[model samples]
Target: MANFKKGVALVLAAATAFTFAPVANLAPVTASAAATQIADATDLNLVLGETKSIKIKDISAYSIQNYTVSSSNKNVAYVTTTTTTGAAVSADGATTGASLTFNYSQVGKTFDIYAAGNGTAVITLTANNTNGAVVTETFNVSVNDKIEHISVKKTSDNSELSTAKPLTIASTDIKATPAASIKTNVTATVANRAGTTLKAVSDDPTIVTVANGTGNTFDITPVKIGSTTVTVTDTDAQDKILASYTFAVTVARADETLKVTYDSNRDGKNEDYKADSTNGHSKQGNAVYLDDDKTSFQIVAESALGRKITYTSSNPNAVSVDNNGLVVVSDKVKQETTVQHISADISVKTEATKIGTTTVPAAEVVVPVHFVNKKYTTLSVADAEGNVIAQTVNSPVDLADTNKDSKIDASDDAVITLSTKDKTSVNLVVASNAGDNFVSGEVFAPATNGKIGTTKSDVVTYANGVLTVAKTDITTDTRAFLVLEAKPSTATYGANAKITLQILVTTKNANNVIDVAKTLDLNASTKTATIAAKATYGNILKYELVEADATQADGYKAVAGNSNTDLSVNASTGLVTYKSKNSGSQVVRITGTSNATAVAPKAAYVTVNYSVKKNASDLAVAAKSIILEEGKTAAIGATASTAITYVSSDESVATVAADGTVTAVKAGSAEITVKAASDDKFDEGVVTIPVVVSKKAENTVVPKPAKVTGVKVANVKGAKVKVSFKKVSKAAGY
Candidate 1:
C-alpha cells in the first residue's frame, strides 16, 4: 500500500492522467504534468497578384495557445486573426501580395493563412492552457511577387479628332517589334486597303504637329487604288519595346472656288451718276469671294463709281460688260471735263447771222471822192487814181440812207447853225447828194449854190445830194462860207483828198446876232492859246453864257466878247463871262509895283545872298487860309514872293520872326494871305498859308560858326554859333 501510495503520488505528479467518478461515483481528476509547451516557426512565400494557401500542422505536442499575429515587415497583408481559434472561427484572411498572418488561439482550433507573395505577415501560434504556462508558434507568410497589370492610354484628354490615333481602314494590319525580354507582348500591323480611305482630316499633317511618343497615329490619303503600310515600334531605353499601331492613308478630292476683281480703268469712277469728268472717285476696296460650288458669281462695290454690280465671275473675277454695248460703265462717276471722243456733234448760232451781208466786215472798203460846186469856187471829183470825173447829175437829196442800204436814219444826216462876230446871223439848207457818202466828212467855206457862204452861213450833208444856201455876203475879202459833205461814193478815196468849191460874195445884216462854238487850248503857265478857235461873228451881249466843253483836247466853248456883262461864271454850263469886258480872262487892272528893302542890319562882319525883305507897307492884303501839320514851321519868303513883304493877319495864331520863320502856336489853321500887287505886265495872283500845330515839333538846325578855321562861311551875316572847349595843360617837359 505504501508503495502503491508513493506510486500514486508520483503518478499524480508525473503522469498526465484523468480520474472521474459517476453520480456517488468518483469525481474526475486529471493530473497534467505541467506541460512544457513548445512553438515553432514556419516561413511562407507568395507572389504579387497571386494567392497562396498555407496549411500549418501542429508540430508541437501541445496545442497552440492563443497568441498575437503580426506582419510588421511587409506591405502586402494584414493579420486576419490575432489568435488561432476562439468562439470566432479561424480565418483564411483576405490578403494581398504574397503574404498574410494566421495566429494561434485555443489548443484545438486550426488557423489558415494566405499571401500573394508581396504580402508578408508574421503569425506566432502561442500555446496556452489552463496552466499558467504559454507558448507561441510563429508563421511567416508572404505572397509571391507578380506582374499586376499592363495598359496604355493617352496622357491628355485626347479630344481633337485631327490629332487622335488613326482608325483601322479596311482592316489594315501593321506589324511592330517588341522588347526581347518580355514574357508576353502584343504587336500591331497596319495597311491601307485598296478602296479604303482615311477620314477627312480636321487638320492637315503639315499644319498640326505630332509629338514624339510610344504610339502615335499619322493619317494619310491614297491616290487611286493603292496600298501603303506604316510600321510602328514601341521600345524601352534599351530597345525593349511594346506593341505598336499603324494607320492607313487615302486621298480624296477637295474642291473650292474663289472670285476676285480688278479695275478696268485706273481712273477712279465716281459714285454720283450726275457728276461729270470733273468729279472723280477716291478709293477702291478689293475683295474675294470663295465658293464651294463650281459655279461662281461676283459683286463688285466700286467706291469711286458709288455703284455695285453683280455678274458671273470671269477668270479675273471682275465685272466685264453691261447689257448694252456702251463701253463706259452705266453707273454715274465723277470725271474730268474734256471734249468727248463720242459721236455727238456741236453747232453754234448767232443773232447777227450773216457776216458779209448788211453787217460790214472789219476789213477796209473802197469809196469815191467828190466836191461841192459853188458860184465863186470851182468844184471837182476824183477817183483813187487821181482822175477828175464829172459829178453825177441830179442824185436824190436823201441824207438818211448814208450807209447805202437804201434805209433812212438820223445817223446819216448832217445838221448845222451859223453865227457872226458883228451880231449877224443867216439861215441855209444842205443835202447829201452827188458829193457825200462816207461815215465822216469835212466842210469848206462855200455852198453848192452860186452865193458865198458868209461867217453867218452853214451847210451840212451826208450821202444824199446837197441843197444850196440862200445867203447874201458882204463883198469883203474876209467873207467866208461853210460847206459840209461826205465821201462821194462807197469806193476808193484818199484820206487827205481835197474837195474844191467856189462861192459868190455874200452880205450880212448888221442887226443879226450870230454865235458860234469855238475851241481854245492854253498853256498852263501863260494861259496863252496853244491852239485858237475859229472866230465868231455875233452880238456878244445877246449870248447869255459862254460854255466850254472840256471833253475834246481843244474842246469847244462859246464866249462873249461884249463889255456889258457881269463878271460871273456858270459852273454847271462850264461858261465864263462878266458884267463887262473888263472882267474877262483877258481883262487887266493896274496895281502898284513892290520894291524890296533890308530889315536887320548886317552882323559884326559877314557877306551873304540873303532874301530881300520889304517893310510892312499898308496895302490891299488878301485873306487866305493855309494848312500845315503839327510841329511844322513854315518859311514864307514872301506872299508874292521875290521882293514882297508878307505878314500873318493874326500874328498870335502863328509868330513870324525877322527871318521869315512862322511857328505854329496851337492846333488850328490860320490864313496869312495877300493879293498880287497889280502890275501892267503880270496877272492878278493870290496866296494861302495854312498852319497846323500837331503834338510835337520837328526841327532841323543848321549850325554856322561866326568864323570857321578851315571852311568858307556862307551867309554868315544871317547865321551864328557858339563854341566851347575844355582847358588845356602844358606837358610835363614844358
Candidate 2:
C-alpha cells in the first residue's frame, strides 16, 4: 500500500479493527453478530485542520444510504462518505457541520473525516433498520494544535527538495547565476495554513536575503560569503520564529565559479600572463632600443575551460573594468604611466559547470598575471581624408597604391604624378601619453649624407606627423623615414617624446608591369573572357596574341573533352571565348605578348578550364534544424548525386568532419552548410541547416506506487493475512 506511512490508515480484521498506515496493529473490535453491527474504522488523531480516510469492508451487507455519520462536537470535527461502486458522490460536500449523509452511495465504499477545530470530537456511525438506528459505532478523535506537516519543492521542476531536518540546499542543484550570489526558489506545503501567509527574512541581510512569495513559497538569495538564518513566519510575527520553516544558510560568492586569466593580446592565449625579466630588473616584452613606445593596451578575460568569462578588478582605483572589460585608468594611475604600472588582480567567472547529469563546483585558480612598465601606449597616423590608421609603435605599414588607381611606382623626374601639387597632404594624429603636455613637432627623412633618423628629404617634408610631397620637389624616391623632432614653438603637440614610424611610400609610373593572370577558373555562361595586364604607371596595356594551340608543347594536355575548334580569340582586342562541346572539362593554352617595352617575363601564359554539368533534381538537406547535447555526434545528410562536404559556420559551437559527422563542441547555435561537389551528372549545390547544442538532460522524478484496496483475514488462528492494493495506471507492479 503506502509502505506503512507514519500517518493514519484503515485495517481489516474480521471486518472490524483499528487502522494506521505504518502497521500499528491495535486489538480488533467486533459487534454482536445478531444486531446490525459496525464494520472497521479507527485511528482518530489529527492536526488542527487535517483530513483522514477509511474504507468500509462490510459495505456489501448494507445499503450505503442506510448509514448516517455525525460528530458529537459539531465545532470540533466532521465526517463525509464516498463509494467505490461509482455511486453518486458524497452529498457531504454541501454540509460543513458535524454530520453528513450520502444522497446516493453503494454498499461497499470509503469515507473521509476532516478536523474542524483543535478539540476532542466523537464521531458516530449509525446503521439504520426500518425502525430507526439499530447499531452505532463511536470514534473519539483528538485534534492537535500543530500543522499536519511541512515540505519544500523546487520552482524549476516541481521536485521536492530535501525534507530532512536542517534541510541542505546542495550546490549541485544550482543553475547559472551572476557573480553576486546564489538564488533559489522554494515551494512549501503545510496544513492548517488556509487564512495565513508566510513571510521570510534573513538574520543578516548582507549575507543572505529572503523575499515573500505567493502560495507559501520563498526566494532565498545569498549575498556574500557568510552565514545567516532565514526565518519563515507570518508577516505579523516578525520576531516570532517559525520552528517548521527556519533554516541555516551558508553563502558563497556566486552560484557558478570559474577559472579565468588575463589575455593582453586578445588572442585566446596567455602571452600577457607570463612574467618577463629585463633591463637590470626583470620581465621584458618589446625592446625600447628599437623604439617600442607601446604604452596603453587592452586585455581580454578568458575562461580556461572554454566557458564564457566575466571580469572584475581587485583595485578599481588604479584601473577599473568597464561593462565589457575594457580598462579605464584613473587620473592618478595615468600620471604615473612612465615609470609605474598598475598590476591588479582581476576576478572572473565562467558559465556553470555541468557534465551530463552531474554538476561540478567551478574550478578556481590564481592565474599568472602579466606585468609591464608604463610607456607611450600607441602611435597612430591619419590619411589625407583624416582616416586614422592605428599601428603599434615600432611596426611598419607600406603605402601601396595610395592614389587608388591600382599601381605602385616612382619616376626619375620628380616622384610620380601623385606629388602633392595641391595643398593635399596626409595628416597624422599623435596620442600623447596621459599626463604629458605637447609643444611643437617636426618630421625628418633620411638623406645620403645625414644619419639614418637625422637626414632630411628633398622631395617630401613632414611636420606634426603630416607628410607631403610637392610637384616642384625634385626627388625620385617617395620613401619617408620620418623623425618628429622636438622644436621650440609652444604650439600644438608633444613633450620631447621621440616616436619613430617606418612608412613605405609608393609613387606612380615606374619600370615594371603587374597583375598578369596565372590561371583562370571562369564558367560564365557566354564564355567571354579578357586577359588583363596593367603597368606600374597605372595604365592597362594592350596585347597581341602570340600562341593559341590544340596540341600541348609541354606534357600538359587539355582536359579530356576538348577539340581544336573549342577556342576563338580576337588577336587585336585580346578577348577570348570558349565553347564547351562535352559534359566534362576542357583546358586551352594561350600566350600573349604585351606591346610595353623593357619589362621582364614577357611571355605570359594563361590556362582556362571549362566544364558543364547537369543539375541534380530533388536536392535538399534532410534536416531543417538539429539539436544535440555537447560532445554528441550526428551525421549530416542531403539528397544529391555528387559527393558532399559539410562545413560548420562556427566550429567552436559544432564541428563537421569530412565524412559529414557533426560533433557538438559547446552549447550554442551554429549552421552546417552541405556542399555538393559537381560531377558530370550534377552541378554544385549547397544547403545550410541550423544546429543547437544543449546540456544533457537528467531524469529525477519517480512516481508514487499503487494504493491499498482491501485486506483478506483468515478465520483460522494460524492463517496468514493477505493484503491487496488498487492497481495504479501504467504501474509495473505493487
Candidate 3:
C-alpha cells in the first residue's frame, strides 16, 4: 500500500509539470511549427465598375492550406482568388469547394485577391496556413452611377431651345375659316446614364396638348385661344426623376379694319355739290391756255361716295380728256399767223346714284376752256462772237428731231451749217409778233406743238459743242494769290452795241459741302485763295459759264466742244481742257452796231501761288502701348515720311524682325525702337515701344472623390446614432 501511493504521487506530479510547461520552452519537436501568423492586415478600396487586386504575402514556413472569400452584397461586389499555377476561382461564398490551395514548393508565396462591381459591398477573405493559423481581411467596395450631362433640342431645327417667357400665336392662324393647328416637337439627350425616358404634360389640355413620340421626342400642339403651360420631365427605368422643364404658351386674336371714304384735294375731308334744276349740271372753273394748242386743268373730285367717274370733251380737235379728268390740248391744231382766241368745253359724270350706292348717274359737271395766240415771226442763229450765221427763210437750215421720237416738236435741236468752219458757239433768236408776249420756257412740251417754243435769245449749241479757257500766267509777291477774277462785272445791250462775258465761273466746289477746307463758294465775295503744294488736291474747285444768259447778252453765244455745259477738271493736275466738236476757233466778243459788227470783250484768268516748303516731315505711330501674352506676336506699327528700321532692346524677352513683327519670348519686358531711314525730304525720326511677356501657367491635378454608394445607421440611441459605411480610397481624400 505504501509503495503504490508513492508511485501515483510521482506520476501525478510529473503529469502536472508537463501540463504547465511554456510553449516557447518546447520548440524542437517533430511536425512543422505553426505557420507564420499574419503580423499586420490591410483593407481594400475600389470604385464602381472598377477591379482591384490585393496581394497577400505569405511568410509561413509551411505551405498554405486554403483561403475562403465572402461578400456582404454579391450583386454589388464579388471576389476571385488567383494563384501562380492554377486558374482563377470565384469565391463569393456561394461557390462550393471554392478555395485557393498552395503546394509544398510554394511556401512563402503570395496570392491575388480581386474585387469588382457597382454599389457598396464588404468582401471578407479568410486565409488558413497548413499549420491552422488563420487571418481575415475585409475590403470596402463602392460603385456609383455618374451622370455626365443632359441636353434638350428642338426636333424641327435641331437647335438648343429654352424659354423663360410665354410664346404667343395668332387666333387667325389657329381658328381661321378652317381649323388649323401649330405643332412643335422637342427631344432630350441624357449622357452617361441608361434606360431614360422623357415625358411631356400640359397644365390645360383644352389650351394645348402634349404627346410622346419616337426616341426621346415629345410633340406639343395648340388647341384653343388661351394660355397654358407644358411640362417636360426626364426619368430613369426605376421612375427616378432626373430633370424637368416648363414652357408657357398664349394665343391671341386678329386685328380689325377701318372704314373708307374719298379724300378730294387730299385734305382729309369730303365735299358735296348740287346740280342745277334747269341745266342739270354744275360748272367748274375754266381751263386756260396761252396758245391755240390744248391745255389741262385739275378739277376737284370731292364726294362722300368713293365711285369712279368718266370725262368727255366737246371737241376732240380742241381738247381731249383722260380717265382722271385731265384735259390736254390737241396737237393737230393748225398754226394761224393771225392772233385769235379759241374755246372748248369738258364734262364730268359720276357712277353713283346716292351715297355708298352704285346705280344711276349721280351728277354732271362742266368745265370751260380758253386759248390765245403767241407767235414768232423770225428765227436766227448766231456764233460765239454774236455774228448772225443763218436766218429763217434765208439760210439752208434743216430742222431735225434730236431726240428721234418720230415727230417734229419743240424739243428738236436745230442744225445750222454755214459755209464757214467757225461753228463752235451758236444761239437761236426768235422775233415775237408785235402784240403777243412769250410765255415761260416750261410751257413748251415736245409733244404739244412743232415750234421751237423758246425765247429769241436762248442759247442752243449744235452737236458736240465745247467751251474752254486758256491758261494765263500771272506773278505776284504776296503769299496769298487770286486764282480767278471776272472783268467789268457789268454790261449792257442795245441796237447799236451789245456787251457781255461769254464764259462765267459759277460754282467752285461742285456740290460736295462736307470738307470746308477743300471746297470754295464762287458766289461768295471772298473765297479760299491759297493751297499747300504738298497736300492732296484736285476736287477743291469748280466753274461754269452761264450759256443761257450769254445768249440773251446779244453779243456772244456758246459754240461746239468746250463751249458745252458738260465740262470737268483734271483730278490730278487741277487743269481744265476744253475740246470742240468741229474743232472751230473759240471766241469771246462784245457786239458793235447791229448783227454785222463785232467788239473785243474783257477776259477772266485763274492764278496760283507757290509755297516755300519743299516737302513734308510728319511722323506718326498708330498705337502708344499694347499688352501681349507670352509666346504671342504683334506688329510694331510705325509710320514716317520715309522708310524706317526697327530694333528690340532685349531679344530674349521680345524679338523684332526686319518687317516689324514682334515675338514675345518669355515672361519679361523689352523695348522696341524705330528710326527713320535716310531721306532728303524729311528729318530723322525715332520711336520706342515697351513690351511685356507673361509667364506660362502651371499644371495642377485635382482628384475627384468617389461618390457615396450607401449609408446605414447602427447602435441607435435617442438623439444620436452610429453611422457606418464602405469607405472610399484615401487617395481620393474622402
Candidate 2 residue-wise lDDT, 1-734, digit = tens: 11111221122121111121211222222333224334455545554445555555443333323445566665666665543344433323443322223322322346667666667966655554323324556677776432111122222211132223222232223433332334677655554434444566777997666887777677876544456666655422344322235556655322222323343432223333322112211122321111113333344443322333455667777656664656555567555536453455544444343322334333332232222333333334444456544323322112111222112112211121123333335566655433224423444454443323455555556665566663344333254444432221222222233444443333322234446676544443436677665444334344432333323333244333223455555544556666655422333343333233322222345665554434443457767788999999987667676777788999999999987788999999999988888765456887888999998777777766655565455554566555554556866445
lDDT of each: 0.29, 0.46, 0.41
Per-residue alpha-carbon lDDT of candidate 3 for residues 22-113, written as tens digits (9 for 90 to 100): 11222232333232332122343332333444444433343344444566776766655553456665655244345444433333444333
- Cα lDDT over the full model 2: 0.46
| Model 2 error, position 117 (Å) | 59
- The TM-score of predicted model 3 comes to 0.19
lDDT value for candidate 3? 0.41
lDDT per residue (tens digit) for residues 92-160 in model 1: 233322222323322233233433234456543333333434433345555432221212222222112
User: In candidate 2, how many Å is residue 467 off?
Assistant: 4.5
**What is the Cα root-mean-square deviation between model 3 and the actual structure?**
50.2
TM-score of each: 0.16, 0.24, 0.19
Comparing 1 and 2 by lDDT, which wins? 2
Order the candidates by lDDT, highest first: 2, 3, 1
Sequence-dependent TM-score of model 2: 0.24
Q: Write down the RMSD of all candidates, one decimal each.
A: 57.8, 42.6, 50.2
For model 1, what is the C-alpha lDDT against the true structure?
0.29
Which number leads on lDDT? 2
